[model samples]
Target: MNHYRKIGNILESAMKMVLLTGITGFLGGHLAVALLRAGYKVRGSLRTPSRRDATAQAIEAAGGNISNLEFVELDLTKDAGWNEACTGVDYLMHAASPFVTSMPKDKATLINPAVEGTQRALSTARNAGVTRVVLTSSIAAIVPGRGKAGPPHLDASDWSDPDGHVNAYVESKIRAEKRAWDILQPGTTTTELAVINPGFIVGPLLDSDPGTSGALFQRFFRGEVPMAPQLYLHSVDVRDLANMHVAALTAPAASGTRTIASFGAYSIMDMAECLKKAFPAYREKMPKFQAPDWLIRLYALVDADVRANVRELGYNPSLDEAPGRALLGRPPIPITDGYIATAQSLIERNLV
Candidate 1:
C-alpha cells in the first residue's frame, strides 16, 4: 500500500473524520467524491442545508453515498457557528469562496471572509484537536499575473500579491490561503497546515450546472467562441486536483508544506486546435481565427470581467507541475481529455 493509502486505512479504523467546506461547489464536489471513495468519512460545510438536494444528487451520480457525507451549515463572513462544524474532524480542506465573474462591492467583503473564515475554521478545528488541515489554494495564489516581460519564474517560493491591483478573485484566494498558513500557537497539533494550489482547472462537470471553467468549454462546443484568446494557463484535470487534495490531507510527507498542482499551460488556440485534431469531425466547428490583443483590450473597456481576463492575456503562465506530478507518480489526465470530457457532457445534456 502507498504511504497515504496506508495512513487512510489506519485512519478508517478509528472514527476518522474530514471536514470539507464548499462541498457543493465544483472543486469541493470533486474532493468529496474522491475522499469518500478512499474510505474516510467526510463532513462537508454548506452555506445552508436547503441546497442539499443538488449536492446529494451530485454525490449519488458520482457513485458516492449520500449517507457517507454530512453537512454543517456555516457562514464564512461571521464568527458564529464554526466550533460545531470543526469539532472532532480529523482534517480540513477549506475550499469555500466567492469566485465570480463580477467584482465585490468592497474588496474586503471577499478578502476579509477569505482571510477571516479560514482563521475561524482553523481556530475551531485546533480547539477540537484536529491534527491536519489542507487548504484549497489556487494557482491564482501562486501566479496572479505577469510583468512587461511576462511571468516570473513560478515555483513554490513564488506568491502573487493578491492585495495588490490584480483581480479580486486572485486577491481573495491569496488572502484565504495565507490565513490557512498563519496557524501558530503554543503546543498545537492543528497548527500543522498544508495547501494545494491548482491551475486553470478543467474537467467533466460532476453535475449539470456548468462551472466557470466549464462555461468557457461550453463556448468552444457551442461554436460561439468563433476564435481563440491568446492566453495560456496551466491546466489540471479536476480528478487529479481532487486526488492531490486527498494526498495533502492524509500524507505525512505533505504536512507543513504548500504545493502547486498543475500539469502545464496551453493557449486557447492550442486548445481549439487540439480539439479539431482530436475530434477530426469537429475541425470545421473549431475556431480558426485568433482574437488579436488590441480587440481584447477594446472589449475590456466595456466589460470589467473582460478587463480582468484581458490582464491575464498576452502572457504565458507556466508553473512548476513537477512536484505534483512526481507526488502523484503518474502522468496527469491530459488537458485534451478534460476538454473532451467537458464538451461531451454538454453535448450529451444539450447544454450546448
Candidate 2:
C-alpha cells in the first residue's frame, strides 16, 4: 500500500480516536461528519450536555454515522472535562472559537475564551500524547488591515497587527492561534500543529442554527440591507473548509504549516448580484445598489455593527489560494455555489 493508504489502514485497524472541539458549531459539525465518514472514531466536546442531542442529530442528518461518534462535556474557560475528553484520542481538531460580528462590551469576553481555550486544548493534548492537532484558525489572524489601501496580497507568511483597527473577534482569533503555536514549539512537545486559515465560511447548514456567516444569506434574502455596503470578502464553502481540515490530518507537508483556504475576493455588491441571478424570486429583497462610502460612514456613527465593519469598508485584500488548493488537490467550491447552498439551506430550514 502507498504511504497515505498505509496510515489509513493503521488508523482503521486501530480505531484511532479523534478529539474534536466545538462539534456543536457550524464548522465543527461538518468536521464531525467528515471525520466520522473517514472511519475515525470521533469524540466531540461541547460546553453543555444539552447540546449533545442536537449535535448528534445534525451529524446523523448529514449522513454521518454516530455509532463511531461520541460527545463529552467540556468548556474552554473552565477546567472541568478537557483532559478526560482528550484521553485515548490520537488526533485533535480544535475548531472551537468565538465568532461574532458585533463588538462585545469587553474585548476579553471574546479574547479570554479563545486564548485560554486554545491553551487548555493544546496543553491537554500534549499531556495526552496526541499525535497532531488541526487548528481551525481564520484569515483574520493573518491579516488585520485598516480601511486604507495597503498590501497587494496576503498569504500564510502574513500576521495580523494586534494594534490595527480590527474588532474583538479578529483580535481573539489571532491571539488564540498564536498561543496554540507557542505551546507546541519544536522542542517543547511531540504534538504536531497544522492551522487552517479560512476566509468567511458560508455553505449548507447541517442544523437550524446557521453560523454568523450563514446568517448573511437570511439578511440578504429578507431585504435587511437595501444596499450593499462597500466591503470585500474572501469566502470558502463550509464543505471545502471541512475537507481541508481532514486533509491536514494526513498530508505529509502539512505539519507546522498554516494553509490559507480562501478562494476568491468578492465585494458585497458582487455577492448581491450573484444572489439576484441565482434566486430571481428574491430579487426585490436583494440589494439593488451599493451604498456610498460616506453614507455608510454616517450610519456607523449610530449603529454598533456598522461601526465594527467600518475598517473593512472598501477593503478587499488580495489572496493567493494556490497553496491551499494544492492541499485539497482541486479548486475550492465556487463562490456562487457557496451562496446557492447557503440559500437552499436557509429556505429548507424556514430561516428565510
Candidate 3:
C-alpha cells in the first residue's frame, strides 16, 4: 500500500481535528501540547470536566497554543460520550490507559480498562471515519516476558509474552496493543493506525502534579530512595515522545508501524550518578550505592512496587534506535537533559 500517498492527502486538508484521549495525563498532556503547537484543533478528552481549566492552563504554561483546544468528558470504562467525542474528528490519539507501579491483586483492574479503552477508542474512531489513529503503547508491550534467553537486540517487532512471568502492567500493555492491531487490521477500517512505544519517560512537568515518571524523581529528591535498584531503564524524554506522536500523524511511513521512541538504556545507579552531578544540594539524599540483588528481593517482601518489578533486576536489553531517529529526523534529546529537566520541574513545583 502507498502509505505516503494517504498522509499526503491528510496534509492537503486544512486544520485537521484530532481527538486526544487521556489529555490530563503526563504523556497525554505533552501530546496535547505538541498537537496544539502543530496547529491542529484538539478536543482533549477528560474523565471529569472540572479539570478542563487546569489542563488548559498547564498546556498553555508549557508553551502550547490552547486557543484551539477544547475538552469533552469521556471515560475509558464507559461508553457514554465516546461517539459524540469522536464525531467529525480527523484523527484519534489514544493515550488513556491504566498505569500503576505496583502489581494489583486482580490483574483485571488494569487489564480490563486498558484493553476495553483501546476497543472503545479505535472502534469509535473507525465508525466516525477518522483518517488515522496514533496510539500510545509502551516498550512494556514489546520488551518484557521474552525471557533471559530471548533476543538481546529488541525493536518494534518484539512482543512481550503475556502468558509468561510478566507483571500486570506488562500484560495489560501487551494485550491492549494487540487488541488495537486486531481492531484496525489492514483492509478492515479506513483509520490507519500508528503506535508510539516509549520507554521510561521523564521531562519537565506541565503542572504541579508529578505523574508516575516524575514521581520517581520526586522520591529521589525527597530522599525516599536510599539505594538504587539494580534495574536498567530505557529512557525517553517526554517532549520527544510528544513530538513523535505529532509526527506520526502525517508520516506515511509510520502507518501500520510500531515506532520505538527510546534514546538509550541506563541503570538506576546510572541515573543517580547523573542526578548527583546535576544537583549537588541533593547529593546526600541521592542513592550513593546500588542495592544488592538479594537485598532488593528482601525489600520486595514489604514493598509492593519493588515486588512488582523484582524480575527486572539486571534485565537490560539492547534497543535499535534507528527507526525512532529516522522518524525524528535527528538525534534524540539527551537523557541527561531529561533528568535535569525533571529534577528542576519537581523542585520548582515543590513536588519534592
Candidate 4:
C-alpha cells in the first residue's frame, strides 16, 4: 500500500511546473497559455490578484487549459513575494518589465524596477533552486549605439550602450539585461540564464489589451497617424517570441546567452504596405507617405512619442535571427502575418 501511494504521487507529479512573472501582461498572458498547452503547470505572478479571473477567462477563451493554471500576487519593485512565487518551480520566465514610449519625468521609475526586479527575482529563484530562468529582454538592449555610419547588421554579440542617447525604455532594457547577465555570468548563481531579445512584437492578443506594439498598429488603422515615420524596426510575432521562451527552458545551447527573435526590420511605410496588401479596409487608413526627416524632427519637438523615435529616424536596423530561430526549431511567423493578425484582433475587439 505504501509503495502504491508513492507510485501514485510520482504519476501525479509527472508534469513540470513553471513560474512566470507578469502573466497579466500581453506577452505574459500568451506565454501562460502556450505553456499550459504544452502540458506544464504554470504559476503566474502578477502585481494584483484581481486580474486572475479576467486573465484566466481570456486564456480559456483562447483555448488554454485553465485547470493547471494558478496565480500569485507579485510586483517587480517589491521583494516580498518572490521567494514564495519561486518555491517548487522548475523553470522561471521573468517577463514583467515596465515598457513605455514616452520618457518619464523620472527615469528611475523605469530603470530601478527593471534592474532591481531582475536582481531580486533571479536571486530568489536561485535560492529556491529553480533550474533555469528565461528573461524577456528586448531588441532595445541590442539596437542602440549602432550609428547609421556603422555596419547594417547586428546580432547577439552586440550590446546597447546605456549611456548612449536613448530614451528611458531603451535604457531600462539595457540596464535590466545587463544586471541579469552580471548575476549569471560570473558563476554568481547556479541558475542558468537565457535572454530573448524580441523586436516590435505584433500578433493576435488573447485579451483586449493589445500591448505597446499593438497600440502603434491601432493608431495606424484608426488614422490617428497621418504620415508614417521613416523608422524601421524588426517585428516578431508574439507567439513566436513566447515559443522561444519555452524552448530556452531546457535547450542546453540556449543557456548563458541571448537570442534576437525577429522576422526583419520593416520601415513604417513597409509595414503599412504590408497592411494595405493584406487588408483592403486599411488601404486608405494606413499612411502611404513617409514623413521627411526635417518634418519628423519638427514633430518630435512637440510629440514625446515621436521624440523617442528621433534616434532611429530613417535608420533601418538589420538583425541576424538565425541562431534564435534554430533554437525554436521553426522559422519566425512572417512579418505580414504578424501585422494582419494584430489588425484583425484589434478590429474584433473594436479597439481600432
Over the stretch 101-140, how does candidate 1's per-residue lDDT look in tens digits?
5786677767777788878888787777787778778888
* Tens-digit per-residue lDDT, 1-352, candidate 4: 6456435434543588999999998899889977876668999997888888999999999878999999998988887888888878988999999887567889999899899999999888878888889999999998865555556778899888889877888999999999888887747778899899998888898889878888888888888778887878888888888878877887778898899988767888888888888888778888969989899899889888677668777666578878888876766788788888998998899998
Please say which candidate is ahead in lDDT: 1 or 3.
3
lDDT of 2 at 178: 90
Candidate 3 wrong stretches, greater than 4 Å: 1-13, 147-149
Better of 3 and 4 by TM-score: 3
> Superposing all C-alpha atoms, what RMSD in Å does each candidate have to the true structure?
2.7, 2.2, 3.2, 5.1
Off by over 4 Å in 4: 1-14
Task: Give the whole-model CA lDDT for all candidates, comma-separated.
Answer: 0.77, 0.86, 0.88, 0.84
The better-scoring model by lDDT among 1 and 4 is 4
- Once model 4 is optimally superposed onto the true structure by TM-score, how far is the C-alpha of residue 192 displaced, in angstroms? 0.5
The whole-model C-alpha lDDT of candidate 2 against the native structure comes to 0.86
**Model 1 / residue 155 / CA error / Å:** 0.4
After TM-score superposition, the amount by which residue 12's alpha carbon in candidate 4 deviates from its true location, in angstroms, is 15
